[model samples]
Target: MVGSIKSGKSTLTNALFGGDYLKRGAGVVTSIITRIQPGHGLRARLEFKTWDEINADINQALILFSSTPPEDGGGDFDINDEKDRLRLQHDLSRLNTDQLVSDDTLDPNCVLLTEYLSGYDRVKGLVSSEPVTHMFESDDFHKQKDFVGDESLAVYLRDVCLTLEAPRGFGENLEVADCQGSDSTNPLHLVTIQDYLIQTHLIIYVVSSRTGVRRADIRFLNLIKKMGLTKNILFVINCDFSEHETLADLKGLVGRVEKEVGMIFPAPCVFTFSALYNLFKSIDYKGGVEQAIARKDRRRLEQWREENDMVAFSDQQTEKFLKAVIQKVSMDRFALLLVSNLERISSISSGLRDWIRINQDLLKKDAGEVQEAFSKMGKRQEASDQITMVIKDTLDGTTLKLRRNLGNDVERFFDSKSGEIVQDLTRFIRSYNLSIKDYEKDLDASGFLPTLYRIFQTMQQTANLFIAESINPKLVNFVRQEEKKAGDVFEQVAGPYSLMIKDAVKQYQRTMKKLGIKIQDRPFKAVRSPDVDSVKSDARLNIPRLAGTIQYSTRIKTEAILRLSIYKTVKTVKKLLKKPVKEGPDSAMRSLEASVRGIKKQMQESIKDHFLDYKESLKYQYVFKLVDAMSIELYEALTDRMRAFTGNLSDMKGRIENEGLAKDRLAEELASMQTSLNVALKETRALEKLVMIDE
Candidate 1:
């Protein structure tokens, strides 16, 4: 699932499952990806972060309060240190008012800091050296909700895997993931969404009726297109029954959304439904506490049903969406498996029919004629072996050339200094203007340190967005181009060999036909191409974690800020506490410019390290692995087809000679076996026809 916050994704998830297994809220809640799949009974597995991940989260928050980065390039603020903890508390108290939720609460703008400070003692032991896994079964399933719905505990969770008996028609292998909002304030949320998107077979994009289609929706949809995932997406315009006066009003909104979405991708299939209404209707209450809560929601649902006529249409669309999902799960996946098995059946049947014909001809032949027939069969077998060798050598050579060329191309594209992505990021960072005047009011209210922190956050957001918008799309397109190139090259190499294999099969078939054996004459299929779609799941790239270290600078004078207090330092660090107002602002502005330069350097280095890791993954993990797998597939396919025809018949002749059975008795036995094989071939052909029609 993918959408902006408060777009009814969780509600839709519950409606689809026909139960309230997930705890739904109306804000920036669901921080981790939750995967729900069909299983035997109720179960929940919670995966928590490792100690290093926890430390990194704390370091990101504490870096705002720390003076400077250490020599090893880590945060200066240690959680166990008394003075550092005191400084953190002090800094939290004096944080810019605009950055906080309100005077009564801590900063929502910096949720990591706020949650870390409040929940430290509670989660200290929970986060261990290695990652932790906790399982909840049966009656204890509800306990998982506490960790999911609560912001404090949810912060410690990395992911959740829930399994339960789903409604009928839901495949056991099918999984539905409830992902974080696409437009979440946390940059990491977007990164997480992209990661899941790569693995997901279908994306359900939800949009609220109140806001028809926002810029965020278009931007995200555009990104999906660039990732080559626009094909299997289903859009939901989650209707608000209270907002629409009539069915027409809801229909109008749906039309508008579909038109806008069609601009991004053609022929958009949009579904309109009130997820809340469906949720309220789907739940069953036994009695007692559950009944009481159900009563209230039931009343609300009844009112909506009476007031709005669009509920019927919503039901129809919901059914259509479910059917589409079933088709993807059962029909598509099963059809591929079915076709492969049928092809093998066809191959085996053909070989058996040919062997039966050869045996029947031998029964009527004289000893001299039988010897001549054996010689012909021997020549055919030799030719088949030679053909297999040629195909194998050609496939191996082509795969090697593709791997080398693709590796070089990937290396050049992500080269540190002159790479296209590097240059794009460099331009964005150097040209980013950080004017102090934009935050002058907050600067005066909260002093230089707080304002500096805000500036760092602003830059971080901008840079992260830039990468998501520009760099990721470019990488997606580049990988796609390379994938296509590799496919085309392999296709060329496989084309002639495909014909060679077919002619070899045909020659064997003609020899059987000359012996009065009838068989189905049909075109042979080309070699199956390697699945390029694996790039979606295998090659991953996202914005690096730039939140913590963007503000660090060795050039800054931390001692000067420490000697002079918050208010006095704002003036004193500019070289004159008594200087005129204009000159003081000028010196502070100069210092801000220096900080921007330092931030640029940090960002460049971080991106360089990130791409270095990604380059290896793209080459070895995805591209080369894909090539090697394709080579094996090609070799097996060509070898298997010829092997079916050229199987050793000399052993059968040896068995006949050694047993020395009567000729009449042997003929009778062979005729009975031939009759059985013919019946089996007829049945297999019928089944293959059915599979083809279904496909």
Candidate 2:
């Protein structure tokens, strides 16, 4: 069921079920898709989407708002900046995103919404279904509804699915669903409704009879037809508690709606039903049939009558209202319609039995001819061919997935490593005394060698972390995870073999049950422990060096005066305090800057080559070794299943050939099926008679 907020969708759904299975509060309410079914006991289980899903939804909402260019073009919101991000957070909170916006959650969008279920009521409770249904109006369910923006009603709806069960007479095979109103500004809700539309057997569209049909109604009705649910829809012009009026007004409202959406919902399918009177009346009707109306319900009914101006409604007027419901909706029409559909399914099942019998005969003759040809050619080659195909698809798919994940690990290591490298380089460069004229006072003259060595050591550790530690853990976990997928591959290869063997065997033994031919169910021996220990190891080798200092005597920055130079020819260090009259200070710092840049560039290139070769070496050491062993184990498993299936095939054919095929069992089963179909067909007619069909 789809409609605008406060259009009485939940109330109409309850009326269809002929009782209150849904919690309906005053005014427009939150958006929730409630699925109703018949149950052995009254209970509700609600599963909100996971944290990742909620985060994705939040991102989508933020992205929508962010993508739009500011009118003045000042800029968009910077979500990464902490204080700036509060605007979006506050907006979400104001829309009633309570738990989803809490300070307790480090990242609100990424926190899991709590999940719960009202404990199942195995015993029908004493006047508590009202309270039980109200449980849905709390926590993960309620706050999420407030995001869409009707404050008195639903602000927004996201990620809540509810299922309810009414008593037997209202809902047996019948299921009714309600979604957020059609007038919702959010297109996301439309996508959700469109998907669920295909799953439902019927659509109940509740529009307030006061308005007839509006633009939102038109668009949603068109969406319904587009989803191919046109044939199974009823356009309900719900006049829940409108002032009493003439038949002309009801027909007039129906006429206007028919003109607007009649192309999809024909006149026959257009209904005018009471949501308010019907709901209260159902409770009133259930009072005597049930033990008695509880005091709570009686008081509630009095309030509703007062609110809806039904206080003056006498017994005669109430009777007229009910008779009108019987004439228009008949309450049980939807349930009866569901029963008719079930009867149709039974008829289809009978037809399938005939098709199965005829196909069995055709398959046997075709199989015998194929088997004769196959025996002449030999079965071993064919079995090998089939196994090869399975190996390529399953085994190759598993390996490809592993390769992608491993590549992602490699890329992530490189990305983070680059950031660390920049940080270290910046720290190293900025620490130099660019303006110092005396190396003794500012350039760590006493421990110059130690300082240089410490810089080199930091560079090396950073490189090693990127190339070795990062890749090792990722490779180990990837190997373990992929190995399980390969075990699944061996199991996957077992299925098609049995199915092929069964399809072939079904030919000779049309009545296989009588012949006592049972296909053996055997599991493929799962892939044994594959050696992946070799896959886990550091791949880095031959660490790169930037050992030697400047070739010329110079400072390291544009304005620097301090300098310490390691002489390339003499292997001695000299600190330059003052430049000669002919040599300019700017010339020294420029020359020094060039040399420093060259050293950094060379170190980067060396580290890149070191990891590239290490990655290459891993293929021979890990990837190839692991794949070869896994393949051998999986191939053996596939061949074993093939042999077992062939053996079973021969045994079944031999039994059917030696013992006679039984035809009497087939006749008895067919007779039993036909009887069930006939019974269904009879009741469907009786149900059709119970509900007044306006059409």
RMSD of each: 4.9, 21.1
- Tell me each candidate's TM-score: 0.85, 0.38
Off by over 4 Å in 2: 25-31, 64-163, 166-174, 263-267, 288-695
C-alpha local distance difference test of each model: 0.71, 0.43
Model 2, residue 214: what's the lDDT? Answer: 78
Q: Model 1 over residues 291-380: C-alpha lDDT tens digits?
A: 234667878887887864678888898888888877766666555455755675677667766666677677677666666667777777
Clashing pairs in 1: none
| lDDT (Cα) of model 1 | 0.71
* Residue-level lDDT for 416 in candidate 1: 81
Stretches of candidate 1 off by over 4 Å are 26-30, 67-90, 99-109, 285-293, 336-345, 352-372, 513-522, 534-587, 648-654, 660-695
Question: How much is the lDDT of residue 15 in candidate 1?
Answer: 81
